[model samples]
Target chain A: MRATTIHAPRDIRLSTVPDPTITAPTDAIVRVLAACICGSDLWPYRGENPIDEGVTIGHEAVGVVEEVGAEVTSFRAGDFVIVPFDHCDNTCPHCLAGVQSACDHLGFTTSGQAELTRVNQAEGSLVKTEGTIDDALLPSLLALSDVMATGWHAAVAAGVRQGGTAVVVGDGAVGLCGVIAAHELGAERIIAMSRHADRQALAREFGATEVVAERDDAGVAAVLELTGGVGADAVLECVGTDQAIRTAFEVARPGSTVGFVGVPHGVELPVRHMFRRNIGLAGGMAPVRRYLPDLLDRVLDGRIDPGRVFDLTLPLDEVAEGYRAMDERRAIKVLLRP
Target chain B: MRATTIHAPRDIRLSTVPDPTITAPTDAIVRVLAACICGSDLWPYRGENPIDEGVTIGHEAVGVVEEVGAEVTSFRAGDFVIVPFDHCDNTCPHCLAGVQSACDHLGFTTSGQAELTRVNQAEGSLVKTEGTIDDALLPSLLALSDVMATGWHAAVAAGVRQGGTAVVVGDGAVGLCGVIAAHELGAERIIAMSRHADRQALAREFGATEVVAERDDAGVAAVLELTGGVGADAVLECVGTDQAIRTAFEVARPGSTVGFVGVPHGVELPVRHMFRRNIGLAGGMAPVRRYLPDLLDRVLDGRIDPGRVFDLTLPLDEVAEGYRAMDERRAIKVLLRP
Candidate 1:
């Protein structure tokens, strides 16, 4: 099987790797259909986060089940499915609580950027599509595997309500997707903080009512001014930096919630700052599996087109090119067809 | 009028100050009937938090209204009221959203430990008792001004469910009261973390199903073991240190919440650790004014006895002694009578 491999910093290669097999009773062999390069994947690609040498890279994928273990009762061969990044048992207490990201049998299946992949805990990690064979819809369905679900999680956790307002703190793909989620949540107004013209235009198309070109203090002041000094009712913090989180906290109205889904790095949150204003903070890794069914329904019903986040698409053998495009900000997100 | 004044670290003096008069159109002057020392107060009392020399130091109090400003429509002389630590305009947007503590008119009425205290935003900060005060109920009513309300906030914010398990971290007055709040929230099992014999007993009496006389890692381990490794459904973090916050995060079940109400001084929360399990963190200064009515009703109906927190009593002139007993841990809390 041809898969993308990372051997060192700024080192990515397309190499032939051994085909994956069902090694566990709960595992399933899947032929990769579509995969994606994530903002998080860039952390290692930039050499900021250390990556193990020769590890198959990528966690987001849409695949066709080739074989299912005896223990896998919910899926079977030839089924087109959305494969969530994190595989889980789906029967653990945490999974029962709808937090499969914290599943006791949690497994990070990062071989998705390949022609074939083996998924453990298949019953929990894979969700079947209604009916397939729509190549144009593959990118959108693949997004439901991770990024789209993550954006939806941020909007839902922020308590975005009908006719309410929401402020998104990042202008990345997730932030753009969050704008769409906010619209789906029935938010009357959506504010996107963006400095790039292209991203800002995409944000507006995704339902952002306004865009602020400023950063840091100026960004917060702009949100406050837009909110009439009371602040937005819901804040989606898609950037995990200290400044972004602080801006989210500062822009959310008293009694409002800030739902953050960014890969939090070097962030220091003081409870005192949040407590003084009755702010509620809720978010973490998105339980993409939990949101699969609803988001899939939306996709099937033509209610949303989340695939637009993938501005570029490349064949599996060119996975290196996709990563390069994303790492250089040349693409909002890249879809890889395997 | 005599008030408790902090001239320096460990230097508390009962000194004469100008009588508080109606300072704002919405202000009301209340003659102190009951006032208590708080754990947060001890920060300034011990100089951990710098205190402006000669500043009035208490935030919790219950008293009889002596006068109301021309614009004060809800309070008048002879009406006994619960003067919450923070005063706010009831008409502010934040206050209207049930977060009076975050009101634009927020005023920390710190003269509560004095003979006469002037309260601004009288309509929102003062809640009238059902009838004439019961001398024995003074301590409990006074608690509604801060500690009890704070505990209630923790329990409510944590979303404790009926028959769910709750863990109370920190054995201070607020923590003990949190046990009572868990009971009111219908939590079937309440675990109280405490090392003191008296505090543990008080915790059980207040509704704790069990007591863990442990601290730090041991305390968290006991809680996890008691919950069958799933961790508690709701955790109330009454301690504000880094260890306590970390323990609270570690002790909360995946998808569960930790409601913290302590005055955080040197705590830095790592969002990554919390994100891994979808742990929800919500808490801050108690919205005492928003809770005044319900807590007061509970107190008057004999549904709770929170005043037992104050085991020591002293005249206002001996406010210095009251501080000494609390600083030495001789008393769980202290009540000063002016």
Candidate 2:
């Protein structure tokens, strides 16, 4: 099986890896139909996230079950499914509360960008559709595996409600998906903070009622300008850096919340600041598996088109160029067909 | 009028100060019946929290209204009321959201321990009961002005649900009050984390079903041991120090919340830690004014007595001794009768 491997910073290579087999009683083998290069993957690509070295990478994919262990009764071979980022035993107390990312026996299988990947906890982790999916909609379905579900988590975690205004920080794939999520959640006003023309256009297409192309204090001023100087009712902190977190904090109205999903890096929030304003910050790794089912329904119903996040698509062998394009800001998100 | 003033760290003196008079359209002047020393006062008394020398020192009180400004409609002469810590307009968005501490026109009137104190935003900051008769209940009613309410905020912020388990991280007046609040919120089990025997006994009186004397790591371990290693459903962080905050975070179950109401000092929660566990942290300076209406009902009903927190009492002139007793740990809280 040919899979993308990260050996060093910016040293991604397409190499032959051993084919996956069901090793656990609850395991199932998935043949990747569509997989994505996530912004989080860039964390290591940029030498920021330390790795054990030469590991198969990627966590989001739409795949078909090629084989199932004897104990996996819920799924059979040839079942179309969405593979959520975390391998959670969906029966844990945390999973019961819709926080599968924190499942007591949680596992992360980082080999999604490959021809065949073995999935653990198959009964709880895999969500399958009854019929075959259209190739045109595969990119969006692939997004439901992680990015879109993550955006939905941001909106849900921020408590974005109907008729409320929301401020989205970051304009990358997840941020764009957040706009869609907020829109679906009935937020009357969705503002996207983006500096790029192309991303701004995509943000608008995905239901951003307003767009602020500013950064820092000026950017916060712009948010206040739109929110009657009180800030938004809910703020989606899609970028995990300190500056982005600060902006999220500043732009959230007093007594409102900031839902952050981006993997944090060097993020330190001054407790005093959040305390004085009665602000709430809730976000970590998104409970992607928990939200995948509902978000899939929304996508399949044609109510939202989160697949638009993939601006570039290529064959599996061109995966290196996909990384280069995203690193250089040439693509919002790249979809790979296996 | 007579008042307590802090001229330096550990230097508290009873001195003559100008009697307060109605100065704003929303103002009311009250002759204090009861004023309690707060744990937060020790911060400035110890010179840890910077303050201007000679400043009047007190923010929690219960008193009789002596006068009202021309525009003051809700309060008038002879009305008995509880004065919350923050002088809030109560008309801003945050106040409307029940967080008066974050009111747009927030003001703190630091003269509650005086014979007469002027209160701005009187209509919003004062909560009055119909008829006052028992002197025995006065101290308990005064507790509602701050400490007790702070504990209630911790319980409410942690979302203590009916039939849930709660762990209180502090056993001070606030922590003890949190036990009562959690009980009132219908928690099936309440754990009080305390080392002192007197506080533990008081915690039981206030509804703590269990007590843990361990601190730091051992305290957290004790909580897990009590909860079958799943952690409590709601953890109340009544202490502001980093160590106490850490215990609150550690004892909270995954997908549960930690409600903190202590004025934060040198506290920093690593985002990475909170993110991975799906733990939530909420609570700040308790919006005492917001909880007053309901808490007052509970107090008046004879269901709970939070005033037992004041183990010592002195006349206005002995206010200096009141601070001394609290500083020396001889008093859990002191009430000054001015």
Candidate 3:
């Protein structure tokens, strides 16, 4: 099997890797149908995060089951499914509480950007579709593995409600999807802060009522103006930079919430301001396992097409070009067929 | 009129000040029956917070309305009432959303440790009791003004649930009151971190299932052990110190919330640990105005006696002793009668 491996900072290569096989009673081997580069992938790719030589590069994908262990009861070979990034036992205390990301026996299948990957806790981590999905719908189904579920978690964690105003701080793929999630969750007004035309266009198409090209104070001012000076009822911080985190605080109303799904990179909360304003901050790695089922249903029903985030697509062998395009800001997100 | 004023660090003096009078259409003048010293007051008395010379020193009180402005429709002269520390207009958007502390026109009332004090937004700030309370109930009723309401808000914000375990950080009046609040909110087990015998006894009486006489790591370990290795379901942080804040985070389980009612003073959040653990932090100044009605009902019905936090009693003329006792740790809280 061929896979994308991160050897070091700004260093990625397509190379041959051993095919995956069932390693546990609850494990299932999946033949990857589609995989894509994630913003979080950029973290280790940029050397901002530590990475070992030849480490597997991606975690989001749609795949077909090739083999299943004896204990796998809910799925078998030939099933098309969406695999959540985090693998958890559905019966664990944390998973039962709807926080699958913190499941006691959680595992991950990092070789997602390859021809085959092994999924642990198969019954809990993979959600099977009713029937085989067409090739055209692959990108959108693949999104359900991470980005879409993440956007949904961001909106839900921020307590976005009907008639509420939602402000998204990043223009990345997840941020654009957050606009869609907020709209689906009934946010009356969606504000996307983006200067890129392509991402902004998708944001508007996904139901962003307004787009502020400015960053920092001007951006917050624009949002406040749109909200009658009350600021947004909920703000999603999709970029983990310090500036984005601070902007998230500045653009939120006194008692509003800031749901931050971005992996933090040198971000520090201004405790005094947060306390004084009574703003609530609730976010972390998305428990995609908890939302994958509903999101998959929406995608299958034609209610939403989150795949619009993929501005570029290519075959798995061209994964290097996909990473380069995203890193150079030429593409919002790139979809890859294996 | 005579009032208690802070002349400098550790120096509280009784002196004559101008009598308060209704100054706004929504204002009311009250003759104070009782006022108490809160742990927060120690910040200025101990020089941790700067104080202007001769500034009045108390903000919690019960009194009889001396006069009401023309626009004050719900309150009138001769009515007995509890005045929340902060004044708010109940009709504002924030107030309507149950966040009275962030009300659009929020303002603080003068310390009612004087002969007369002015209450702003009188219609919303003053909660009139059914009748004048007897002498024995005065201290408890006065508590409804701040400490008791704050405790209730802390527990409520932390999402205390039936049969849940709750950990309270801080042994001050508010922390003790939080134990009472958690019990009333149906927390099956309440662990109070306190070393003072008197406060510990009060905690036990308020339904604390256990008391740990340690701080930080030791305290968190004790709480976890008490909960059988699972951290408390909710944690109420009533102490604004950095150590107390950290302890609250260390003692809460994943997906549980820490309700912090303490006025933060140089406290910083551990963002990385918080995110990875999926813990939620939500709290600010207690919206006393929002909880007064319900808490007052509880006090009136004898469901809880929050006034027990006051371990020392003194006349208004002995205001210096009240401050000295609290500052020297001789009393958890001090009550003063005019």
Report the number of the highest-DockQ candidate: 1
TM-score of each: 0.98, 0.98, 0.96
Residues B158-244 of candidate 1: C-alpha lDDT, one tens digit per residue? 988999999999998999899999999999999999999999999999999999888778988998899999999999999787888
Please tell me how candidate 2 rates in CAPRI terms.
medium
> What digit string (tens of lDDT, one per residue) describes model 3 on residues B202-224?
99999999999987778788888
Q: Model 1: per-residue lDDT, tens digit, A155-193? A: 988989999999999988888889989999999999999
lDDT of each: 0.88, 0.89, 0.88
Q: Name model 1 segments beyond 4 Å from true.
A: none
Best-first order by DockQ: 1, 2, 3
Better of 2 and 3 by lDDT: 2
A169 in model 3: Cα distance from truth in Å?
2.2
Error of 3 at B20 (Å): 3.3
The predicted structure with the larger TM-score, 2 or 3, is 2
DockQ of each: 0.83, 0.74, 0.66
C-alpha lDDT of residue B129 in model 1: 69
- Candidate 3 docking class: medium
The alpha-carbon lDDT assigned to residue A164 of candidate 1 equals 95
